[model samples]
Every structure is written in C-alpha cells, then in structure tokens.
Target: MAELLVAGGGIGGLAVALAAAGRGYRVTVLERRDAFTELGAGIQLAPNAFRALDRLGVGEQVRERAVFIDELRLMDGTTDEVINTMSLGTAYRERFGNPYAVVHRTDLYQPLLDACRRTPGVELCTGAAVTGYEQDADRVTAVLANGERVGGDALVGADGIHSAVRAQMIRDGEPLVSGHTIYRSVIPMDRVPEHLRSNAVTLWAGPGWHFVHYPISGGREFNLAVTKDDGAREAVTGRPTPADHVLAQFPEIGPKAGLLLRLGEQWKSWVLCDRDPVPGWTDGRVVLTGDAAHPMLQYAAQGACMALEGAVHLGSVLDCDAGDLPQRLIDHNYALAPRTARAQQVARAMGREVYHPAGVAAKERNAEIGSLSQAELHGKVAWLHHGTP
Candidate 1:
C-alpha cells in the first residue's frame, strides 16, 4: 500500500487521513501539538460539509453530536428587524441531500480523532512539527523540527495558514490581515435567556460590525462570534477580552442584539487574516490543502467546509495507481483551486456587502435580502453547497 504523510492534525488533516485509509492507503499524521484538540467554540456545517463528512465515514458520528438548524436569520443590527430568513430544516435537507447543522468544534474534532484511532492503516503522532521537506522523483520525506525524517510516497500540507510545508514549497509571504477583529465566546445554554436561546443561526448586521450566535454542543452551549472593523492587525488568540470591551464595540446596536452581545463572558479575540488564492498548490510529491492552500474570511462561514471538501478530494485523487502520484497531486490542485478561489473571493464580498454596511448601503442590502424567495436564496448557494469533488 502507498504511504501518505500528513502534516497537521487539524480537522482537515484528520479527514484526509481517514479518507486515505478508507481507500486502502497507509496514513501517518504528525501534529505539532502534544495532544489533538480544537480551540474554537463552534462551527456551521452546511449540507456540502456534511456530504464530505459522510464520504469520510464519520457522518453519522457528526450528526449525533450536531444540532440540526431550522433556519438562518439575517437581521438589521440597529433595528432588530429580520431582513430575511433562509429555511434549513426539512426543505433544505430534501433539496441538498443532507441537513444543515452546527457543532461544537470539539464535538466535530473528537469524532474525527476517534475514527482515526480506530482505523487500521492510520497512525496519529503528536509533537512532531514539520520543519521542512525533501522530495525527489519517486518519494518525499517530511523533515521534523527534532531532526527526524519520515519518508512517504506523498506529503500533504494541511498545517493551517502558517504552514511550514507551504513556506518551503511556495515561499509565500505572511497571510494578509483584513484589518478586522473578532471576539468569540461559548456559554452554557442555561446562562442565555430563554428569548436568546435560539435553535437557529442568527446574524445581526450593522454599519461596521456584525454579531452571530447559534446553538452548539448538542444544545448544551451557545456560540457567539462578533466581528468588527476596529483596524487591529494582529492575530492574537486566547487573550481574555472583557465583556465590557466587546460591548463597547457595538454601542449603537439594537436592544435585542445588545442583549445577546452582553450575555457573552470571558470573550477571546483574534484578528482575521487570509491569503490570496494562488495559482497552484502542488510541488512534486508535496501538496497543500485547507488553509495552507486557500484561507478566507469567516463572513461566508465556509472555511472549514471547504477544507473538508478538499480533504475528501485529495484522498480520492491519491487512491489511484502509484505510478501517477505527481500528476494526481497536480490534478488535486486543479480540481480544488477554482472552487476555493471563488469561495475566497465571495467571502470577501460578503464581508463588505452583507456583514458590514453603512447607511444607504445597509438599507439597500436589507431590501435585496428581503426580496429573495426561498428558491432564489437556495439558488444563490447551490454552487457552493452542491459542488462536486
């Protein structure tokens, strides 16, 4: 069997390993962290992401832990009026062949990790940071920080946005900062008032900021994320941001939106950053997937979904005969680049047009959203939710 070495034990890397192992390949995953853990609070998995999870053999596990959402409501932050609502219940499932759901990051990550552990041909190694790599005509070897070299038929760089493997292969500069900051928190569902404990994903859009909240962790917790254009350009993580500091950013928000924002405690903030879509992501036997290949803003909430899709595609392409390994990697890049590039572009557009708008522009956005019928709303995202690997 062919050996596949994956750098990074994130959701994307583990999904890739599971897919590869399912296809009869021996897979080894190296994670920089000593233990596999996800830091974020929650994630929204549209039907497209669910399709990828199902193909990786973890769909049922994910579904058991996920909270199936009924609708997505876009509201005017200053007026507390919902501009539009998209149905995500049975109609959505019937149309997309899967359900739209939200999950705690750990709830999703743990199952992938457990599946990896149970798989026969998959190996999970921690504390192995990939520093560099060496590759030739036949095989590639990932160089670890501790000076160990692991050889494999192919090396996959799923090491996230600051990927060491990408640094050696593409030599791209630092990721571009969006001059936007986000404060995130997850609180016990019981802590949220009954009125605020929504079973749906709700987004409040204002002039220069937006707030989103949803039920996660099997309805035990609520995940809140607030994004604004405060021009902070540093990507700080896990720093305790006071609830007051978060509230201060949205002084003019409506009472309903304010109530949700004020409910969050012990918020953590990070500066948003992404890279421009590159022309290619494959170099010989080494290939890039997920954030390493195409990082995007969270406005569209498709970052992790895209990563999951790419993982399945990468594994499927590599499961073929060994003689075409290099070409197959190139094919993987070609297959994924266009869709991810479009997603990146659309995400940026959504930040400007939908998430943060001012005065007349905001009104116009509301009008546009309110005018969309259910079919039109579904058609707008058909390309993304129904994309093929």
Candidate 2:
C-alpha cells in the first residue's frame, strides 16, 4: 500500500483519511491545531453528502446526530408572506436515493475523527503545521513547521479555504471576499417557541438580505444563518453582536423570526469568501480537495457535498490504479474538477439571486420561490441534491 500524507484535519481531510484507510492504504494526517476541533456552525448534509457518508461507514451515526426535515419553507421577510414550499423528505429520497438532514459541525466531525483514530492504517499527528513541500519525480516530501520532513508516496491537500497546499499551487491568488457577511448563531430547541420550532429548513428572502433557520440534532436546537450584502457599510467594528442587534438592522423580518434572532446567544459574524475555479488541482502525486480546490459561496449548501464527492472520486481513482499513482492522480483531478467548477458557478449565481435582488424583483422572486411546487423545487436543485454526477 502506498503511504499518503493528508494536510489539515478539517472535514475534507478527515473524510479523505478515513476513505483511504478503509481501502487499506497507510495514511498520516498532519493537523495544525493542538487537538481535533470543529469551528463554524450547522451543516446540511444533502442526499449526495449522505451517500458519501454511507460509503465511509458512518451514515447511521450521522443520521442519529441530525434532524430530518420534510420541507423547505420560503417566506417574505418584509410582508410575512409564504412564498414557496418544497417537499424535502420524500422528494430528496426519490431524487437522490437518500434523506436530507442538518447536523452540528462538531457532531459531523467527531465520528469521522473517531473512525480515523480507530483505523488500523491511519496515523494522526496534531500540532504539525505544514510549511512547504518538495517533490521529485518519485515522491513528495512535506516540511513541517518544526523542521521535520516526512516523505509520502502522495499528498492530499484536504486543508480548508486558506490551504497551504493551494497557496503553493496558485501562489499568486487568495480567497476573494464575496462582499457578503453572515451573522450566525445557535439556540437550544427548548429556548425556541413551540410553533417556530417546525421540523423544516425555513428561509426568509428580502431585498439585499436573507434569513434561514432549521432544527438540528433531531430537533434539539435550531441553527440560524442570516446573510446580507455588505454594500456601503463600514467595517464590522466589534465582536458578534447579539441577535437583537441583527433584528434591529432589519426590522422588516417576520415577528417570529425577529424575536427568535433576539433570543439567540453567542452570535458571530463571518465574511464570506470564495475563489474562481482553476483548471487543475494535481501536480504529480499531490492534489487539492474541498475549499482548497473550490471555495464556494454558501448559498448552494453544496460546499461539504463537493468535498465528500471529491474524497470518494479521489479514493476510487487511487484504488483503481495503484500501480500508476501519478496518472491516477491526474485522472482523479480531471474527473473531479468539472463537477466542482459547475457547483462553484452555481453557488455564486445563487448568491447573486438570493443576496442582491433589485427593488420589486425581491418580492416577486420570493413569491415565485414560495409558490414553487415540490417537484419544481426538486428539479431546480437536481444537480446538487441528486447524486447524478
């Protein structure tokens, strides 16, 4: 079995490590943090994502930690009108052959990390920051911050949006701020009012901003994500303001949503960033995955899905041609790049529509989305929610 080195122990890195180890390869993952930690908020595992998890042998565990929803509710924040509703429970199962669920980021991370730790062929080393790498025709040598050098038959850059590997590839580029900032928070399920705690992924769209909320952990709590275009606003001055601060920014939201926002604690702000897709991700035996390869806008919710797909495709390619590892890496990049590029474009377009609609167009768009039949909504996201690729 070829020895592989994976950088960054985030979701993508951990998934790749588990997938590769399950295939009987010797794998070592170097994570910069002191321990395994998951930052960020809720993650929606669409059907395609679930399929990937199933393949990695943690599907049931993921389901147990997530909330299953039947529909996606769309509303107008300004007028408090129901714009559209899409059936997710049956529609997702029929379209993608799996269920749609929302999971806490930590809940998703722990299972994958635990699997990797228990795997026979996997070695995880924390506090080892990768400084650089040197590759000859035969192998790649990763340089650690502590001046230690580790050799591997191949390297997988499963690092995150600010990947060190990606920096080495496209040395001239950086993640471009998408001019949108999201205010995120999570509240315990019991804290939310009974009626507002529907088992649905609810979204309220308005001019220049949108609010989304959904139950996670089997309805144990709600994850709220509110986004707005950062137009002419000044730099964010202080720490994440309370939910009341968010509601005050836009008093136009529905009373229930605004009330919920005011009640949320530990509010935080994240400036969205993305990069244009590149044509290639492989240089000899080293390759990029997830946000490193395609940093996408959050509108499509396919960022994690794309990472999962990349892990599966990369593992399949390597397993298929263990003898020709370099060629296999190239083929793997080719197979994965187009799908990621398409998803990146779609995510950016969705961001434009959802975050910057003009004048009356916002209300019309909201109404149209709200009125969408379950079938139409399913068809619209078939490329993403369905495992067609």
Candidate 3:
C-alpha cells in the first residue's frame, strides 16, 4: 500500500488522513502539540461542510454533537433593531441536502481524532513539528524539528497560516493582519439569561464592530465572538483579554447586545489575519491544504469548511498507482485555487462592507440585508451551500 504523510494534525490534516485511509492508503499525521486538541469556541458548519464530512464518513458523528440552528438573525448593534432574519430549519435542509449546525471546536475535533484512531491505516504522532520536506522521484521525506525524517509517497502541508512547508514551498512572508481583534468565550447556556437564549445564530452589526452569539455544546453552552477595529496589527491568539476592554470597544451597542457582551468572562482575544490567495499550492510530491493554502478572514465562516472540501478533493485526485503523481497534484491545485481564492476575496469584502460599515454605509447595508426575502437570501448563498467543488 502507498503511504501518505501529513504535517499538522488539526482538522484539515486529520480529515485528509481519514479520507486517504478510507481509500486504502496508509496515513501518518504529525502534530506539534503534546496532545491533539482544539482551542476556541463554536464553529458554524453550513451544508457545504457537512457534504464533505459525509464523504469522509464522519457526518453522523458531527451531527450528533451539533446544535441544529433554526435561524440566522441579524440585528443593528447600536439600536438593537432586527435588520434581517433567514431560516435554517427543515426548509434549509431540504434545499441543501444537509442541515446547518454549530459545534464546539473541541467537540468537532474529538470525533475526527477518534475516527482516525479507529482506522486501521491511520497513525497520529504528537510532538513532531514538521520543519520542511524534500521530494525525489520515488518518495518525499518530511524533516521534523527533532531532526527525525519520515518518508512517504507524498507530503501535505496542513500546518496552518504560518506553515513551515508553505514557507519553503511558496516563500510567502508573514500573514497579513487585518487591524481587527476578536474576543471570544463560551459560557453555560443558563448564564445567557432567559430572553437571550435561542436555537439560532445572532449577529449584531455596528460601525466598525460586530458581535455573534450562537448555541453550541449540544445547546448546553453559548459561543460568543465579538470583533472590533482596534487598529492593532500584531497577530496573536488565545491571549487573556479583560472584559472591560471588550465592553469598551462596543460602547454604542444597544442594551440587549450589551448585556450579552457583559455576560462573558475569561475572554480570550485573537488578532485576525489572512493571506492573499496564490495561483498554486503544490510542488512535486509536496502540497498544501486548509489555512496553509488559503487563509481568510472569519467574516464568511468558511475557512474550515473550505479546508474540508479541499481535503476530500485532494484525496480523491491523488492516485499512487498512477505514473504521473506530480501532474495529478497540479490538477488538485488547479481545481482548488479558483474556488478558495474567490472565498478568500469574498470574506475580506464581507468584513469591510457588511460587518463593519460606518454611518451611511451601515444604513445601506442594513437596508440591503432587510430587503432580502427568504428565497432571495437563500439564492444568494445557493452556489456556496450547494456547491460540491
């Protein structure tokens, strides 16, 4: 059997491993952390992500732990007025062939790790930070920080936005930081107060700031994410941030949204960053997937979803028995680049015009969102939700 070596055993890497193993390839995943874990709050998985999960055979597990959201509610942050609402209930499932849901990042990661563990041909190795790679005609060798070398048929760079493999392959500089910082937390559902609790995703948009809260942990907890234009460009994650600091960023926010923001404690902050999509991400027996290939701002909420899509496509296209593996990788790059690039560009646009518009632009954005009928709203995202490529 052919062997596939993957760097960075996060969601994309593990999903790729599972997909390859299912196709009769022996897969090994190298993770830098001491243990496999995910840090963050909740993640919204649209139907598109679910389709990829279904193909990887973990859809049911993901669904079991997810909160099936009923609606997506948008409100004016300064006035607490409802701007627009879209349904994500049964009708959405019927249209997209999969339900829209949210899950805690850890909850989602656990099942993928468990599934990888149970698979016969998948191996997970921690404390193995992949430093670089070298590929010859027959095989590719991954060099780890500890100086250990592992050889396999191909090497996948799933090491995230600051990927070492990407550094070597594309030679891109540091990721571009968007002068915005995100404050996030997950609190018990009961702590969210009675009137605020709902099976929906609520987004409050204001001038230069936005707040999103949704149910996660199977409806037992609420994930709160607030983004603000703090004008700080340093890229940092999981850093301790004061609740007062977060509150100060949204002084103009209305009462209800203000209350929800105050409910958060032990908040962590991450500076948002992304890279401009490139023309290609594959070189010989080495390739890139997920954030390493196309990191995007969180406005669209499709980073992980796109990664999942790319993983399935990469696995399906790679054939060890084929005489032209390099060309096959090139084909994978060609198939993914256009779609992921569009997503990346769209996300940046959404962050500016939709989430953080100011004054007149904010009113126009609200009017545009409020004007959308149910069918129109669905139609706007149809290509994204229903697309397989």
* Winner by lDDT: 1
Off by over 4 Å in 2: 232-239, 320-323
Lowest lDDT sum, 10 consecutive residues, model 3, at 317-326
lDDT of 3 by residue, 1-389 (tens): 88889999999999999888987889999999999998888998989999999988899999999999899998999999999999987777899999889999987788899999999999999999999998889899999999999999889999999999999999989999999999998899989789779899999999999999998998888899999988978999899999898888888999999999999999999999999989989889899999999999998889889988988988897645635667888999997788889999999999899888999999999999999999898888887788555
lDDT of 2 by residue, 255-361 (tens): 76677667678888877888898888888878988898888988888998888878877777767444588898888888777778988898888766754575777
Candidate 3 residue pairs that clash = none
Regions of model 3 farther than 4 Å from truth: 320-322
Q: Which residue pairs of candidate 2 clash?
A: 83-370, 83-371, 84-370, 84-371
* Candidate 1 Cα errors over 4 Å, as ranges: none
Cα lDDT for residue 91, candidate 2: 47
Per-residue alpha-carbon lDDT of model 1 for 1-389, expressed as tens digits? 99999999999999999988988889999999999888889899998999999899899999999999989999999999999999986767788998889999988899899999999899999999999899889999999999999999999999999999999889988888998899999999998988677789999999999999999989999999999988877877678899888898888899998988888998999899999999799999999999999999998889999999998998889778777999999988997898899999999999999999999999999999999999899889888987564
Position 10, candidate 2: lDDT: 90
**TM-score: which is higher, 1 or 2?**
1
Per-candidate Cα lDDT values, in order, are 0.91, 0.81, 0.91
Instruction: Give the Å error, residue 329, model 3.
Output: 1.1
Task: Tell me the deviation in Å of residue 382 in model 2.
Answer: 1.1
